[model samples]
Target: MKHYIYLFTLVCIMMSCKKPYNPPVTTTNYNYLVIEGLINTGQDSTIYKLSRTVPIGSAIANSPESGATVTIENDKSNVYALKEIRKGIYAAGLNLDTTHKYRLRVKTTDGKEYLSDFVQAKDSPTIDSVQYEYTGNAENIYSYTHDPKNNTRYYRWEYQETYLYYSPVPSYYIFKNNSIVPTNADDETQVCYISDTSSTILLNSTAKLVQDVIYKNPITVVPITLDKLKVRYSILVKQYALTADAYNYYQNLKKDTENLGSIFDAQPSAAATNIHCISNPGVPVLGYIAAGSVSQERIFIDRSDFYAASVGVDYSYCGGAVITYKATQRTPYPDIITIGTDIPTDSLVAAPILGSKDSLFTIQYATAACVDCTLKGSNKKPAFWK
Candidate 1:
């Protein structure tokens, strides 16, 4: 009887094998509001960026939430309105008292209202230094700071980087007045400044340690092959002290959305936000508002600091095609002389073709991008550039 039962069970298990399972597509709609930015208590301007969340598979990251009435209010009912400078950005000059509690209030174009939890302003300590360490193929930037009162144990950082870039070919001519004229070296758009801001959330905590000291906390890393490291590089780091609640909110956000869809990772959970929809109690709003005075420091790194082996990747792909201009050809030269529209191509001085007559010659030229650095960056140097 036992042998018969075992044979039946094995037959049942073999028959149970079937095709792969396909989960149904999720049809849920999400249009939650996202508020970002801190309430500045210092002399600097306080800016808020408002946007609506998009679907996971959508090509657009976040849809701008525009035409909103944004204000910073204190517990004492003092309100400061922020001007909508652009599509979704709002800005206002602030000099709030550090002792009072503050929050952000928003009235959107759709007539919906939202408010952030009241938060006390936290002051950030000055960064002792912004240092760097060169690994085998990358340079890592780090910051150090400490709170003497041990009040600020949680911290967040944001940084902006600017680098000097140069064109592979120096442009020496411009096509103007229906003729090619020699370009002045001073006005030559060969060198330019390119800048970028931090996107990922960077946070640290010194709560467990006896002293509130953050040492060598890595802020960002620049690969040696990146063009930013090819010449001179500069970074401006801004530090903000966070409340425990605010720190936890950002930490959870980083884990859920920032590192989503990784195998062996924690299951995704909805990040709790301090903001709420005043018009509807159950509706979800995304983001946390923190009140604080930001501390900033800027550092410049020269190309001489790196090893020759780690200089930079070859950017020869930038420009190479050569067009020969001959005086003999008529019919008003082709528009190919310019890069895309107006920018003129560069002249190859070393390999100019000499004509039979002493005064006649043909010159080799290439596209504007290869010769104009301004195509990728600004020709004007930054005021803070050293």
Candidate 2:
């Protein structure tokens, strides 16, 4: 009888297990509305990307918005119609207006309309003058300084430089009163033509304007022609608080360890340190200082010929670790041979060394900065000294 009872209990447990368990029902509803391709500023014609949201836990199998009319209109009468450049990439053909706010409106083929909240494009700050200083050291480093007066600001620069080159050609020199200066007429009367026409010269060179671009953003846009050369670059620079904690964090970074470790390595050198390595190399080590906090700030330039020859991968940004190099080419100036002690300005201009516009020396810009460090007590130590 006990065996029969155990069999019945087992049958009852099996029956309970046969009933299927149900999962909790989720009530989350998803909508298809996403805004992309938002530019930093609205001053120029920028693309405003729109897309539908993929359902959660759903596989995306060739999901594309077949037919959609996307329009971006500002409070003003600036209506921008978007063209489908590629799949899901709707380009708005209107330049940004700083004066008015803008909104994105989308209409689907199924009579469903979607609208986005008005978002103002951030304004770009004014760009100050760009100054380049060349170095005489063998490393051929150039230092560029962008001295923007504004302190509380974040900015990036895109350099578009037009390099000019001219070749020599012979032509007749017609003098005043329709008198032609004969060729090989005299040492001073020979007719020669200085070529003034300039053509775009493509530099066949590669430079590492940025290295280990894990930190610096890479540009994805198709190489756009600025002037007459292909261009590439993408960078992100933000403003951070200048504080001890922030400085400490940077100091502890592997890239910044060398400079930080040198803080406590200060010692009196037998000679003066070459503070201006660009101008004076192998100068003496004036003194050394202890490590202290330093605020690091920088800007990112693009990867172009303007950067390839002069800037290196580690020196692309305006701040941080920098190694400079010299220009590979030198300028040629003409020297004049004359009898007079004082050469006339008119005659001097005809000589190669005197009238040459090109400089034998060119500077290559690299990124580097000085951090505050502690120094040893000196014989003329002031009250601030311990």
Candidate 3:
């Protein structure tokens, strides 16, 4: 017993001696410029995102690199300027000729110049389809595409998903000017649309196959519990063609930026980039500029396909919250507190009101966010929504 007790005491001392090591990577502020996105040779707009690498333990999730001048230049010296669509996001479609090689040039606000190696434009095959299969618990989405010429061997995909969902209960009336007003069709706050984009790097290769065909490339998985699958949902899959070298860059990038949950996980290192900082050659830039025409396909899934599997978002809290009790809400004064902002969700008529008259009743109200679908998402439907 004494030996076991001694061993336990020693183990505790050894465990207490363990300390966390904050590596130089975390302590150092190495904000390297990260250039992302493609240079489209098609009618679709070419978008590029510029951001700086944030050190570990940053409160902000992203650090966008703004005020940078980005442009695409051809071997013939034709330069097409890109406009900043948003902070750190630059986009513009180029009248690109497939015969000519292209490159990107960037001038940061700091007056530093970066240029990418000239790359030939890649032609992407049209996406055959975007399909989804629902297993009671989840929905698995896939992308299908093929290049008959066998010229396009490498591939990458991105997706944008939009869905229609509704509030737990439909609000028939709206609170306006401290009065309950009957809601019109335009003012209905029951259904709404929400959108999300792909965050993961999706890639596939058919280099060694007899035909350059991709089958059921896993795009994303949707949990039925999310509001996403509550009603009608649509996914637009965008496919890009990648060269052999560009494919390697994306693969390395996916590894360096992800899967760091523990100290034993792979530490991030600079991924190879075609972009070179001419001002300071020693400085590291992360990204490769690929010139390609995008292929797209969209598919919609209605709840009827798998309605029984969905449990949807629970908004019962919006109903159980009783802000106050009232009597004769018609008075709209001191008998009951005036609903300054929202419509009363429920009203009791000819029921005894607490601390008020017997003939009067109670009105239960909830915050606008709880009852108004527009608060969470746009009530105005998308043009393509069916």
| Strongest candidate by TM-score | 1
- Cα misplacement distance, residue 197 of candidate 2 (Å): 42
In model 1, the Cα lDDT at residue 237 comes to 97
- Model 2, span 131-155: residue lDDT tens: 2222221111111222233232222
* Candidate 3 local distance difference test against the native: 0.82
The parts of candidate 3 lying over 4 Å away from their true place are 1-29, 172-188, 262-267, 307-309, 325-343, 346-361, 367-369
Expressed as tens digits, the lDDT of each residue in 124-184 for candidate 1 is 9989999999897889999999999999999999999999998776666655566656767
**Runs in model 1 lying further than 4 Å from the true structure:** 1-29, 56-62, 173-188, 324-331, 335-363
Q: For candidate 2, report its TM-score.
A: 0.28
Error of 1 at 39 (Å): 0.2
Whole-model lDDT, model 2: 0.32
Reference-based TM-score of each model? 0.83, 0.28, 0.82
- Ranked by lDDT from best down, the candidates are 1, 3, 2
Candidate 3 lDDT, 271-325, residue by residue in tens: 6789999999998888898997999888898878875633677766676344433
Evaluate model 1: give its lDDT: 0.84
